[model samples]
Target: MADDTSGLSVPPKKLSHSELKEYAPGLQPRKMTAKYEKQKETLLRDRKSIQQLHKQRVHRGQSAATQKYESRMERKKIDREKKLYPRNREWKDADYFIDQYLKREAQMKTERVRARKIQNVEVKGNDEVMFVARVAADFECSPKVQKIFRELRLYKPYTAVFLRRSGENLKKLALVRRQIRVVKPIRQQVEDLIRTRGFAKVDKQRVALSSNQVIEERFGEHGFVCIEDLADTLMKGDEEKFNLVTHFMWPFKIDEAFNDQSNKVPGVGRSAADSGRHLQDKVEQFPFRFMDSLMEQACRRGKSRHWMGPELIKALPSKKEAKFLMKVKRKKVALKAKERKIQAKFDAIAETDRKVARKLRREHKQQREEKKAAALASKNKSWKVAMKKSAKAKEKKEAKRRGEDRRLIAMYGKKKSTAKKRPPKKQSKVE
Candidate 1:
């Protein structure tokens, strides 16, 4: 207790902990102001970070120890699978499912084949892969064949796909095999194909394999060391790697002009190989020409393998061509102008002739009218003379009988003169 100035007893004010801490070094309460909103923002930011942490923990939580070891292992495996490939977030879910389904089916097929081998049952599958080029589009075929085409990705004409010669594949292929030309491309042809028409799929876009460097960069270290290796592998590599090699390449699209080329050259190698294999007891082969056929085959083979230097490009007319055309058009225009000028000159001459003819016609008409008038005047003059003579004779006879002229009468019944029309008055001048 302490005494105040007025002599009344007073108690000393106690210092609160917060007030003491505020006065202490490096410890003070926050300043309050309406302008500052950083505190609330900081709180909100902390809340969001905490929520993220909680979600992470929940998503990555471990299995309980009380759970069975098998169940925990299964749960961990499911979590790993979900993390590795989230089904909900995938766009190609059906493709994944199909892949899994195919893998399972392949396993089953192997098991069945094993059982059949043990039981001495027959099995069918081909090891060789052939280059199948679609020459004709036959959507009008039955739905089964259309489905096969869809699977093979050979719906477009002049496009080719690599197809394994499995029994099932061949059976499906034979249904429409005539429309497709299947041939085993040689090493040279394979290299030529990759060199000329090789394209790679990058991010679902077709990128042209412009050089050997591009091919090496893309497919090195895995299977192919260089473009040559890839081409050779595609041609005569292990049959197992055939599908894998083909997957790197886009379907080959032969130009329309080269559509039937594979068809023609398919027998070139085979015919050459078996030409002398059997010379006798085959058929009555007379004068079998070889040079022409060989040359044609060689030409076709060259054209089929290599691409031309540059495609035909259409362009606007050049300055020289345009100038020549302009000169031609100018000549035509000048000829037309000269023709019009000649026509105009001829028209002027015709007009002058027409004017002269018209003037002569008018003069002749006037002369005819004048001649008629003169003849009528002469006849009228003669008639009038006869009439006057008769009238005078009669008048003389009457005069001889009467001998006195009648008295003249004065003008008394004449009409009065009418008023003349007045002339229009002119406008007065402005002041």
Candidate 2:
């Protein structure tokens, strides 16, 4: 120990090993306050106690490795549950499924051929898609056309429906061909709708086909796990699967009113397509244009693929449409401005006449009010006169009943002092 320099003999304090070591030029040991040291000690003690209690409660004595393994196995179970019924995610069973689909398609083809033979109608281009729109409103349509519209499920104008290019279906379509325009469906527009606007039935509820789960759950037996697979099935004319999917999906509501109305010739009965009335040249763009902005909004929300069906149905107009509307709106504003100017000019020219007309109107109103008051006063006087006449008649009748002079009382205006005091009715003295 080093000797003490003070007069009193005091022991020199020993420095800690950490403190004994020289740090870098400016670096020094952190100075700890008494409160800080106390807090650190208490925290360490509490942590130790918690760990001991946790260990005691977990009597299973499972180690970290075992717990980690159990958690991993639980995750694997969830992943397995999420997997398709086949247990294999890949389309390994696609060949057998395709064969099954082909067999059904062949059966449908045979049925259609038999139907065509009976109907004596030939349907060409089996792969072509027809886009049909109802040009007539339900209220104005004929009974026969109304029944056809009901069958097609299009009861309103701007309503669109799709038809397959098959013989029997084409025969049905031909019945309403005049009312609806049948055009070739655009592949891009169709694909976009299938991708964005498509829905699948889940638990009897219409759920959006955002994830592959609903498609897999419903169509997994047929080897379809996603939208692309479903589209391919429809393209290949897998009748059963196609019908099931179509029934599951809701009808596409298309608004073709966004097109130009100038082409609507007053007497012409032709379609807008023939008359060049469409706002967009590409017919396919109509549906996608109405639905594109909505899909973009959905995508922007950074939502997971599990969005519901109604959200996808909320279609908004596009920038081009907004511009068209703005142009139309400007014309409307100009017309309104012109009308307002005409109205103002008429008001200015007739200002003095209008003031004189107002004075005459006020005078007529006052006369009407005075006439009404006079009529009311006359009614009251007539009521009082009637009451007095009724009273006089009643009094005369009473006087006549008593054998008194009713005529004399009326002429004299006095009742003859209570009718001569009833002449002191003669009474014989009873013996």
Candidate 3:
């Protein structure tokens, strides 16, 4: 060990601990020390100086910079307030612009309305003149024509006839003829004939004239007889030549002329008046007895019935009565619709019930089958357990018997075996 230590370099002599402590007081250990006191004091003094400098800097910066920031914020707030308030100058300017625009728009609208009103007036005046012209062109004096002309103020005391010389003369003459046809005498004759003979019988009947009579009647040594000639011959002197037969035939001819004229234009009150006359004729020709029979039958059935008499004879309905009937009909229709809806609901309920019952039956059948299956499964499980138990018991019994047999054989195997064996002596007997 001395030799191994001799190969290593010698270390320097270690000084005594107390001599080292005297040389380096810093290395000396003491029971108590104030090592951090001076450093803590220096650090606290530095911190105090830094704090004072920071406070002076804050104080110096606060006045001008804070004032500048506050002034800027206040200016921004004032600008925002101006933007929001309507009393500001900008808002007033916007309002003035809007008001001016609205005034201009309203002025333009007024001008448009006035222009439209003037145009409508001109159009109405033109329409009236055209209406008058049309009526003059297709002048007739059938009951329908009379009614239209009367409605148009043709028969008024202030009315002035404006007859044209050319084609209008024929139209005026046609009107005159129609007027003459509506005479009371002609109407009475036609009514009497209608009452005496049915419409079908009258329609089937025809007027017949022999060939000589036709020749004599149509052309008696002169050219074809013109309507003007007949009119001149018949209305000579214009002493109000009136005949019952002519008056009766006149209405039909007048109606035909009116119808033809009406078909041409079909505007104004003329066509409407013609339609009214046609309606009147139909009403006059209608069988009242049939309506009476229907009413009587309805009355017998205990149902309320109304017989609408001749249209001309019926009282004009008041607005209130018409409104009331309309309301009543609406209510009746609503009630009928409600009843139908209720019937449909009942039918739906019945159908739903039938479906529900069918569904329930199907469910019940399925449930029964499931229950039966569950019972069968449970029975099978029980049978399996019983079979397992029986098999276990049988195995135990067999094991017990085999153990007993082994013990018996071990105790009396040779003697029991010899006694159970049988000798064979049949071979000696055969020798």
Give the Å shift of residue 297 in candidate 2: 37
lDDT tens digits by residue: candidate 3, 200-224: 1113343222123432454455432
List candidate 3 stretches off by more than 4 Å: 1-334, 353-361, 414-431
Q: After the best TM-score superposition of candidate 1, give how far the Cα of residue 304 lies from its true spot, in angstroms.
A: 22
Candidate with best lDDT: 2
What TM-score would each prediction reach against the true structure?
0.31, 0.33, 0.22
lDDT tens per residue, model 2, 246-356: 666655544423444543333324333343334234445455332221123333443311221222213224468669989998998999899989999999879978899
In model 3, the Cα lDDT at residue 41 comes to: 85
Tens-digit lDDT string for candidate 1 (1-431): 66444443342477676765644534456676755677788889999999999988776664343356778889999998876776766365786779767765764564444333323422254455467765444432345445667788776655677666554554455345334555555667667677677787777888888766766676776657666887777656676567677877888775422333332222112232232222211212311111221112222335422211011101123468769989998998999899999999999999999999999999999999999999999999999999999999999999866643232213344455698889999999999
How good is model 3 by TM-score? 0.22
Q: What's each prediction's clash count?
A: 0, 0, 1
The global Cα lDDT (0 to 1) of model 3 is 0.42
Model 3 CA lDDT for position 412 = 79
Looking at model 1, which ten-residue stretch has the lowest summed lDDT? 307-316
Task: For model 2, name the residue pairs that clash.
Answer: none
The per-model lDDT (C-alpha) reads: 0.58, 0.59, 0.42
